[model samples]
Target: MSKRSESFLRSRELAVAFKASIPVMMGYSVLGFSFGLLAVSQGLTWQWPVLMSLLIYAGALQFLAVGMLRAKAGLFDLFVAAIFVNIRQAFYGLSLLRPFRKTGSLKPYLIFALTDETYALMTTRKIDPRLKRRWVLFYLAALNQSYWVGGTVAGVLFGSTVHFDTRGIDFALTALFVVLAMEQYKAKRKLLPFLLGAGASLIAMVSVPADRMLITAIVLALLGMFALRKRIEDV
Candidate 1:
């Protein structure tokens, strides 16, 4: 294909992909709204989620990072802590290289949107070049950001009036993780990493406090992946 033809095709593909991701977009909005509400209750302002949606994009990482802030954690401490929670993204990126290599400028957005949910949707594809790869990434980035932004706005408005307990809300995140894990398990080979990760995370949760469990889980998952890299490739 000519360069111009490829560009046009990519754009069209992205548009179609965006349209197809409507359900996930709606889910993002609802989840983001819940996150925003939680943020406000923790004494944060709208700018926080706005900035977080634009920059961090990783929902679980941001959620964990905010707790450090709430505790007045030192900058260095926050960095050290977040590094553990977010190290999984590096693995996601490794698996995503083929899809993201064609994305050019959209590569950063694709990387940013590599949340558990987004990864679940994109990686299930058995074939590729299905959409202009760049466009596929753009659609994912835009859809996720829209959800996060919409949720933040809703949370800011509703936080004051709602009085229900939020303890159950934490489970929303857990459920998302479970769904993502289940999706990753379609392949038997993939099950090894998923189980490895789950086992590591469970061990960490047992040994660490809620605030630091993310770091522990990340460390253990990374070590587990490294040790089992050969087996992980068999799938």
Candidate 2:
């Protein structure tokens, strides 16, 4: 690449970051808004969503945690459930370790903020330099977090009057997983995880209770991960 082109890319990384962040910003806001509405409806205080957004920051996981808490689950139960539900994120981060090595001071934030959407965007995006990559990563995190915080604030303010259908809100998590799975398939052309998840779900649906479902899925997912590690590395 030419020196001028490289310089321009570095300078314009913010624009790339913003453009890449738009889709995630939209999805997270709506989903986060829905969670906020549900939280308030379940008698949670306004700060609940804020704390969730700040502390957990995993969009789908936080929403699931809220649901479990609303159901009167204990802290230990919630923690264990979260371990199973979010173990996928550990794989997501592992997949990005090489791509994220050059993020410098922003590496921690990039790792922490790597939701499925952000991971998809980062993996697909083509940038020239390490600086540009970090810029993109930082912007994705900032924008997504903004959406979550903003949506939660809006929900807290207007949840009482916004009598909309929430039946479809749960699909946000499902949709994200589908998108991530598709991304993985696109990258590796693998069907193992998809089949594994389906098989596990079928077994869990028949044999596992509601609370145990995630646990079973986690075990199955880990086994699948180890089984496919060689395929993944080869790919």
Candidate 3:
């Protein structure tokens, strides 16, 4: 393609990516805002939210980081907690190894920007097949990150002025998970998978330290899935 043609195609790809990422735009904006609000409420600088979202881009972990910052968590402690929390991304990365490998310069950014929402959209392959897959992935990652960064900036700017009477704000995260689970079950209509995950989590909660339970649960669940892979496929 000529220069003009290439530019047009790139724009088109970005437009499609923006449309596809609308749901995530809405979600990340709210989630990012909440994080910013929480951080500023704890007397953290606005720069912290912007920097965290720009560099780290892990929503849930950033929320936890707020508490860690308040408590002055040590480097080793932060490292361990991050490993335990984000270990599941290993599975996500492994699954998308092929697609990401083909993305050339975008490969690094795609890996870095593979938030849960971006992973879901990319793996689902909902974008037009005619669009270059690598470009599509690139735009999606870029646009999603932009949305989050914007949201964090907004929250930090306005968080101090707007006080929310959010007494039960903590439950909102749980509600979002329940909604995601229901959406998955609705899409696939499979109960056993969620049940197995829940079982593993419950076992870990009872057997492991609170700080360690999440990773243990995920490990146990992955093992259970591997053992039952054959039967689960029968579904």
Which candidate comes out best when scored by lDDT? 3
Tens digit per residue, CA lDDT, model 3, 72-176 = 766765776688678879887798998888789878888898878889988885767767889999999999999888888888878878877645554566677
Residue 102 C-alpha lDDT in model 3: 78
Task: List runs of model 2 lying over 4 Å from the truth.
Answer: 1-11, 128-131, 160-213, 216-235
* Candidate 1: residue 209 Cα off by (Å): 7.1
- Report the C-alpha lDDT of model 2 over 1-235, residue by residue, as the tens digit: 8999887775677677877788877877787787788777666888887788877787777778877776676787778877776787887678888878887988888777778777888788877555566776787777778888888877777776776665666566777678978987898786766777788778877887776676677677678778888875575
How far residue 228's Cα lies from its native spot in candidate 2, in Å, is 12
State the local distance difference test value for candidate 2. Answer: 0.76
- The lDDT values for all models are 0.73, 0.76, 0.82
- Per-model TM-score, in order, reads 0.68, 0.71, 0.76
Better of 1 and 2 by TM-score: 2
Q: List the residue pairs that clash in candidate 3.
A: none
Clash count, one per candidate:
1, 0, 0
Query: Which has the greatest TM-score?
Result: 3
lDDT of 1 at 208: 79
Model 3 has an lDDT value of 0.82
Which model, 2 or 3, shows the larger lDDT?
Answer: 3
